[model samples]
Target: MINGILFRQRTGLPWRDLPACSGSWKTVHDRHRRWSADGTWERILRAVQADADTEGRIDWSMVSVDSTTCRAHQHAAGASTRAPKIPGRRRSPARHRSDEALGRSRTRPDHVGGDKAYSSRRNRRHLRRRHIKHTLPEPRDQRANRQRRGSQGGRPTGFDKTIYRRRNEVERTINRFKNFRAVATRFDKRA
Candidate 1:
């Protein structure tokens, strides 16, 4: 059942298209759905993360963040108005995000590395308030405007060339996720 479920998930196949070797696709689908609703998947992830942390395989010192646009299918829109809305399901999850699993962690990362797109004064202020170190390169326009302000602009934001290089870790992580068909295609309408 697990294999069947994983296969379906990996391939992003419709429930009806699942192979017969899986033995009744409905059963596998139901099991996956039930497990998902019961927080089994989240539990599994937490357990694995715990094990990795214990083994010193997971680093907690720094958190890398980057953005990548996920292209949606042309058919993503045009949903049937006749269908009832699912309560608690967000309208546009891709645009509107909620607190993620990492946000729930008790331990805060000491540092954050992000892309230039995330380089905003508000973001830096928030990070300062949180007392977390960040490595986000300021955009060219921001630099020019800051320079235009002269003394009022204050000193340039402290950026480390060495630390910024590590920012690519998040970009690589995003690329890895894109290897999954569902993530690359954005087949689902909601997210």
Candidate 2:
């Protein structure tokens, strides 16, 4: 049943339009929803990730964390104002927009490279916990905050300028992922 759902997600098929050959689509969809609600999906994903780590599929020596905005149709927009847009057109008639769609995790080849948007304390802490080398530029707000606090603010975290150049690959990867119609359209109703 779970496999059917995975297939639907990979193929970007409407839930109601799932093929009969895959078995009862309703059963699969229901199971998927139930698992999501119960946090079973998260646990499964974590387990697989852990297993991959143990088997060496994951390179903890370097990992990247970045977010991409998957633009949605005006009809798909939610109640958020900062959502992705259609671009080029001047007017936007959508009532609500969300900037975030789905998040995908990837293993960085050597070191994680990101911009100021990823400079949050929590993100830095996560990288530290994973023991992954990273370079994330500081945001203007954080810099000002540190300056205002003087010695109390402590020194800003060191960021590698050379490694940060590699951050361009993150954007390239996002572009490649978006090449898939399913990813671009966000046909999967489930997160």
Candidate 3:
């Protein structure tokens, strides 16, 4: 099952078109659905991350964060909706987000770099709480809001041009990852 999913990720195959090398496509789909519902994928991703950290592959001295929208196929929309909604629930998850696994840890980076999308107060506070210096430019709206509040608006957060230069590392990483046709092509229906 694992090999099938990894193959899909590598080969950009439609889930229904998963090769029979491992098992029936139905079995792979069933397993993927069950794992998605049970947070198994989250656990697996975190485990891989932890292993990388343990192997000294993670450098908390510098890190960056950004989000990208993956265009979804129209056919993908109905899968979650067809599932029975919980009592009193209003809507299906646009994208499921699961909890961090036990033992998951985020080290304090010497410097953090991100774009305007990450320039929210809550994100800044979280980084500050960890004592991680950040170089994200304040958005124009946030600046205006702060100025409007006068003394009540805390001082503008610090920004460092030099540190921000390292933000390209994350962009490059994304480009490299997307160089794989499967990743770039959005073969998986889900985010």
Candidate 4:
């Protein structure tokens, strides 16, 4: 039964389409929903993660977190097939002017590679409060402003070019996640 659920998850197949070897599709789907509602799945994960942690198999030092936009699949769009998938691909009087519409087990990471978009002072302060060291590059404008302020500019943010280069690891991970049809389709309308 569990294998049936696993099969569906990996292939992104609808419940009814799950192979018969595992069990009746209805039973597999119902079991999945039941386990989900009862927190059984979360319990299983916690148990596995705990065992792995004790065995020194899991790394807790740093966790990369990032986000990206995924296009809605045609089936997900219902009858609204006329809407342009690409924003601003064509300009028409009737075309909408909108450009685009855009988990947390770990409390914190020992270190983080940050995007320039997250280089705001508030974000930095939050990380500092959590004692998280981040490798975030300052924008040119921010650098110029600090220089313009002279003595009142405070300390320059710590940036390591070597560390910033590793920021792509998170990006690549996100891209890999997009490879899953269930995710790429944004079927649930949420990430």
Candidate 5:
């Protein structure tokens, strides 16, 4: 069933097209839906990350955050609007407040690098609050606007050209995820 689900994700194939060897496609889909709704996948990711951290194989020195819009297929539209309730009593306060969208590592990274698209005042302030150093280049228009305002515009945000160069790594990582057809062109209708 896992294999069936992975195959569908990798190929962006219709659930009905899943091979018989992988068990019934309906069964695989059902399991996926249940696990996703219950945050099983998030738990698994956190567990794996914890193991890696314990083994001293995970890096916390730096991490990047960025978002990409995957063009949804026609079939990917019209998911139910109701939010799925996670199954279980409330956990620790920290765990409950953690952002799952950031993935397994909720710890603040020493440094973060992102593209201009992520260079918003709100995002910068969020990073500042977390004490995570960031390297994000200001957009041209924003730079110009700040300059036009003279000293009243406040000092230009710090930018490190050398550090910003590493942003390509984030871009490359995103590109790798996009290599999976289902992720590249969101075929799942469920949000």
Candidate 6:
């Protein structure tokens, strides 16, 4: 059943088109719905991350954050209207306040990298508060605006060209996710 659900997710195939070898599509979907509603997937992911951290398997030297917008299919537009009324399905209290669908790290990494889109003053301030070194290049217009303010413009933001070059890795990772048709097209409408 898990295999069927994963296959469907990977291929973005409709439930009716699921292969018979993986068992009934309805059963697979039902299991997925149940697991999702119960937060089983979240628990599983947390456990895996915990185990990896305990085993010293995660790299903490650098981290990257970025966002990508996916276009939703027309069929995926209506699920938000049918909210599930399941009991005892609230989000965990331990979840980080900063969690926003982007992946999480167990520890603050030594350095962070992102694109110009994430180089806003608020974002930089947030990173500063966290003491996370960031390599986000200011957009030309923003730089010009700051310069227009003279001394009040403050010192230029620190940027490491060498580290910023690695931001391409984040872009490639997003592209890989978009390779999954369901993710790229947002087949699941519920947020």
Choose the strongest candidate by TM-score: 6
Stretches off by above 4 angstroms in model 6 are: 78-106, 188-191
Residue pairs that clash (backbone atoms under 3 angstroms), model 2: 83-98
Instruction: Using TM-score, rank the candidates from best to worst.
Output: 6, 5, 1, 3, 4, 2
- Tell me the TM-score of each prediction against the true structure: 0.76, 0.56, 0.69, 0.68, 0.78, 0.80
Looking at candidate 1, what is the lDDT of residue 73?
62
- Shift of residue 93 alpha carbon in model 6, Å: 21
| Cα lDDT for residue 23, candidate 6 | 95
Q: Across residues 1-191, which tens digit of lDDT does each residue of candidate 1 receive?
A: 99888777678776668899998988997887788779888778766766665566656566787656666566565556775433322222121112245343435577888777778899899999999999889999999999999999967988988888877777677667667765566444442
Better of 3 and 5 by TM-score: 5
Best by lDDT: 6
The per-residue C-alpha lDDT of model 1 at residue 98 equals: 20
Query: lDDT per prediction?
Result: 0.70, 0.62, 0.69, 0.64, 0.73, 0.73
Q: How close is candidate 5 to the true structure, as a TM-score?
A: 0.78
lDDT of 6: 0.73
Preferred candidate (TM-score higher): 1 or 6: 6
What ranking of all candidate models by lDDT puts the best one first? 6, 5, 1, 3, 4, 2
Please estimate how well model 1 matches the true structure, expressed as its whole-model Cα lDDT: 0.70
Candidate 3 lDDT over 44-91, as tens digits, reads 877787777666677777777765444443444443665653232122
**For all candidates, what are the clash counts?**
0, 1, 0, 0, 0, 0
- Score candidate 5 by lDDT: 0.73
Candidate 3 deviant stretches above 4 angstroms: 79-81, 84-106, 144-153, 176-191
Error of 1 at 162 (Å): 1.6
Candidate 6 C-alpha lDDT tens digits along 1-191: 88898888889989889999999888998888889889988777777776666666766666777777667677765553477422222221111122224354555777888888788999888888999899999999999999999999878988889888876766787777778787677565554
User: Which stretches in model 4 have alpha-carbon errors above 4 Å?
Assistant: 77-108, 188-191
In candidate 5, where is summed lDDT lowest over 10 consecutive residues? 88-97
